[model samples]
Target: MKKKLRIGILFGGRSGEHEVSLLSAASILKAIDKKKYDVVPIGITREGRWVTADDAHALLTGSQPPENPRLAGDPEATPTAAVIKRGEAIIVPPVPAESLQPLELHAAAELSPARPALALDVVFPVLHGTFGEDGTIQGLFELADIAYVGSGVLGSAAGMDKAAMKKLFAAEGLPQTPYLAVLRSVWRGNPKAATKKIETALRYPLFVKPANLGSSVGISKVHDRSELAAAMDLAASFDRKLVIEQGVGGPGAKPRELEVAVLGNDSPEASVVGEIVPGSEFYDYEAKYLSDASVPIIPAKLTAAESKQIRQMAIEAFKACDCSGLARVDFLMEPAKGKTKPRIYLNEINTLPGFTSISMYPKLWQATGLPYKQLIDRLIQLAVERHREKHQTRFTRV
Candidate 1:
């Protein structure tokens, strides 16, 4: 029999999106092709404890942590940065050897484990937000010389920061709503001045967001000066910087939420357009995961030409940000009510979009004829292909 590739599935990270990660990982773990791959479920608890199990899906979906998280050499208590002298963890070779074989160390050093949790052929990080999605974990994968699915450190960090992404989009001649970014220091030292700066740049009904987070953890739509200060404070609570974007899809605006999925490396392809009908005030955390009321319109109701144009724009947006593996580019469509030509505005892109059964990313692909299982296979293949390309690059110049 051919040897199976050992894939590490990481989920339940230290972020507001912990539960969301688990859901994504659960779906991925369920759909992976076991014949071609050996699954390794490594879960990080809310307190940051690392645990391996045959049932990571259950642990993640349920509210409580695992019953037997402590392996023989597993630590008595979990550490934040993960010092695995004695814990349900394994060492991934941070520095590489000339021959390219990674050093695999177990927690007990005597477990005789079939495969050390750390020595993965590739990793699929189903984590979102904070350390998980914002380049920190991606950097770890880079240093450990492990092949990880999704964007690299630069792309992940840039994608996490709305202000940075906007700057890149602007430089690429991409259209974006007017916005302002404020630092925590400035807000704390002179909040009034910070508020004035925001007031000066954009109009009211602005969306104040924590510059580095998603799942709408800290976001608000401020209609007036009275709410602007409070909204900034709320966003500042989640991250050091806060972003305020002009309200684009409200009462007077188009109010359309469109999504496009991009796949592969250098020459990525865009999937047919999808639409989101948020179940709440907007696509907030609860409306995204908990609510069943929200709906997605696959091959969204639009003219053939309009759909083609939106999909094309989505690809440009993905390339503009130098994305890899996969991304979901979201846009807003301002349809003509009577006289004006309809305008399509690119909102933002999610490098690591949710894989919930209801999430638009996977749903769009499934509609494109790739089932969940096949989609997982394709992504794993992409990871290996990308890794091979990187391996061919020489580190030192003669």
Candidate 2:
């Protein structure tokens, strides 16, 4: 009999996409192969507390953990005691170690016991946005020397920031829309000047976004100067840097939104292209998670040549940012007019894309012949492979 690998499923992080992360984690927890791996549920609160135990799953799923009988009837009593009793907060040591240490909180000292450290073979972070996906947690994993899923620090940071991602795409000679990166301070310091600079570089019908956010949390489409100020304010509230991109299509036509999933390390492969028909004006946060009207077309309608070109571009964009393990590369295709072929522009890459059951990342791979379970397995395998490869390099002078 073979020993089962203990995989820690880290979810529910401190980000705007925290709820989305929980949804993704729930799907993974249900779908991951149990026979091959011993799954450990680790939940991080919005306040940044790391917790683990049987109740961790419950907490992530938004269910009430088993409460103490003594405090069940007390209206003023909080569930904090029951949560601490059922779940133990954890501390991941930066130095390479085999297990996670339990954090002893003074409030729950009596309720919680000092237990043996929890051992983990690998960490599958289902976290999204800010602290989790922007390389902060990846940096911690690097310091801890743990094999984790998704891109490394540099890849994650660059991927999260649209400005940096666009620069990388431009350097790789991959086609993308014209855009300007503006700082919140500069925009606020001289609104007229900042607006003038953006107006000069890019035309109206622009997309304004926070450079460091995901799931379209702080995104707005501005049609003219009337809406530009409001969009800038909204974007600036989410991130210090804003990426203002020129819209691809002309007149009333909307560009086709396409996506490709890239998987592996060293040599990566792109999945079949997929298209998103946004329910709203754009694939805003509401359309992505809140609404049920948005529809996804797998193996998007495209000519063989066009599909091949976009797929290759996706791989190129992924490698340009030094991404490993997995990523979902997005693209915008201008509507073809007359006899001319449509032009494809590479959009920003998502290092840690949503992994919910309906997410395009897994769906694209599934359409490309890899099912959800096998995709998860392959990602874990890639993470371990990358970790081993990294260890081969000499860190000290000979």
Candidate 3:
């Protein structure tokens, strides 16, 4: 009989997107196929504490883990740690430090029964930003040599930073709106000079964003000089690096928001295009999650040629960012106006996009004939395949 694969669904991170990640993870826990896999629910608190089993359940349900000794005495109920080394997720006693003082403790601890590892076959990190979505956690996965879902370290880092992603897109000759990257220190050192430099380079109606954030958090649209300072300040609070982009269109026309989902390891396939009609002036954090007014048009009304071009561009952008497993590529398009063929610009690529029902990434694939559950299955398969291929590489001279 085939053994049920042990799958770990990691959620609730230290980022501002923690709540959103919890929602995404909850959906997976309810919908994932239990017959084929043993699901492990791992939750990280906003304070960065990792919890599992009953503790994880408490975190998910808004209940605090029992601190009273009477309520927390079960040894098995204790929070278990997940470690990836020797190519599998395990829960072993942490190796002691190499220093002499710690070495004595290590020697003494070796006499005790080693804690059995959790043995996760694959980990699906539903975490959204900062330590989770950025390359930090991905690097830990690489060191553990375990198979996990989504892009590797390089891709995750690049995808998290808008400035870095745009540079890669530009190298590939993809069309994009003009923008400037600002460092918090530089802006603070000389606000007047920074304002002058921005005024000289771009026009009004610019977007200020924290380069390494997702879910439209710490983002603002500024119309004139007075608003730029506050917008920049807001963005700087989230990240040291800031990205200022020139608005896509002029006047009453808002640039059409289009998204395409790409799936696979190398030779990925692109899903049908989907359009987002934001409820607010722009798709702010409130409009993306808090409100239900936003509308999504599947297989967005586009000409056959435009659809083909967008699908192709989506794959190109995914590769340019070195993404694997899955990604959602966003594009800004100007509708065809007298003599002007619709101009499409590669906006950005989201390596670990939202998985909620209303999220565009999964929705785009569902529209392309791949159901939600099937999409999850395919992604797990891709992670296994990629890990197997990576193992083939000879790390040491053999």
Candidate 4:
């Protein structure tokens, strides 16, 4: 009999998007095919502490695990034992051990009975921001020589920082909005000088964002000099680097928000285009997660030529950032004026995008003929394939 693969779903991270990550993880836990896999739930607290399966499940669903979980095609099998304590931290050793070792840090002094280390065939990280999505965790996975989902270190890091992503896009000759990267120190040291530089280089109605954040957590829209100072202050509080982006479209017109999901490695494919109609003036954090008025249009209405151009640009943006596994490339299309065709500009690429059931990444793939479960399966397969390719490299002298 073929042994079922053990899959680890890692979630809850130290980031502004922590709650959003929890929602994404819950959707995956419910939708994943448990019949063909032994699903293990691993979670990290906001304080960066890793917890066991039962604790992780409880944290996610606010309920305890069943005394015995049903195995695939078996009703009379022996009960599976819990491997680690509920609150104990699970450490991924830098050395290649292929198992997550649990550090016993409980108050009790005695050691427990011998148990096998929790082995994972592959890790699906639903962590959405900072430490989890910004290449730190990917680096740890590389050190452990484990197969995991999403882009590698460089891609993840570049995708997380807006300044770096825009630079890469420019280097690839992809069309993008004008923007400036400002260090928090420089801005704070001379607010007048920073304001002058930004105003001189870009027009009003600019977007102020923390370069290293996702989910629009520290993003602000500024219309004039008075608004710029406050926006800079808000963005500077979140990150050391800030990105001021020029807005698209003319007066009183909003640019259309389009997104395309890219999947695979080496040779990647672009999904059907989707659009977001922001409930607010722009797609801020509140309008994205908290508001109920925002709407998502799958297979966004566009001319065949427009769709093809945006889709191709999405793939180009993905490759330019060296992304793998999956990414959602965003673009802004200026409002058509005086019978002229609208211009499309690549906004950014999200390496590890939102994975909630309703998130655009999965929805775009679904609209492109791939279901959510199948999408997860494909991502896991890609992770293993990439790991195998990495193993082929010669790290030492022959």
TM-scores, all models, native as reference = 0.88, 0.89, 0.89, 0.89
Alpha-carbon runs more than 4 Å astray in model 3: 66-117
- Give lDDT tens digits, candidate 2, residues 1-398: 98897788888877889999999999999999999998888777765655676556777769744442111111222223222223233432222242234323334333334343345678899989998889988886776677889899999999999999998889989999889999999999999999999999998789999999999998999999999999999999999999999999854679999999999888999999999999988899999999999999999999999999999999999999999999999999998899998899998899999998789999999999999999999999998899999999898998
- Candidate RMSDs in order: 5.0, 6.3, 4.6, 6.3
In angstroms, how far off is 171's CA in candidate 4? 0.8
lDDT score for residue 120 of model 1: 66
Superposition error at 198 for model 3 (Å): 1.1
Judged by TM-score relative to the true structure, which candidate is superior, 1 or 2? Answer: 2
Candidate 4 least-lDDT 10 residues: 70-79
Q: How many angstroms is residue 15 displaced in model 3 relative to the true structure, after the best TM-score fit?
A: 0.6
After TM-score superposition, what is the CA distance of residue 219 in candidate 3 from its true location, in Å? 0.6
CA-lDDT, candidates in order: 0.76, 0.83, 0.81, 0.83
> In candidate 4, which residue ranges exceed 4 Å CA deviation?
62-116
**Which regions of candidate 1 fall more than 4 Å away from where they truly are?**
54-58, 61-109, 112-118, 249-254
Best by lDDT: 2
Candidate 2 error regions (>4 Å): 64-115
User: What would the per-residue lDDT of candidate 4 be over residues 311-375, giving only the tens digit for each residue?
Assistant: 99999999999999999999999987889988999999999899998999999999999999999
Query: Compared with the true structure, what per-residue lDDT tens digits does model 1 show for residues 1-398?
Result: 77788788888877888888888888888778888887778777776655665435456667554554434333322332232222234422223231134223335565546533244688888888887878888876776676778888877888888888888888888777788888988999998888888889888778899999878788887888998888888888899998888887554553678999988887888888998887876677778878888888898998899899888888887877777898889887764668766777888888888987667888899898877788788888888888888899999996
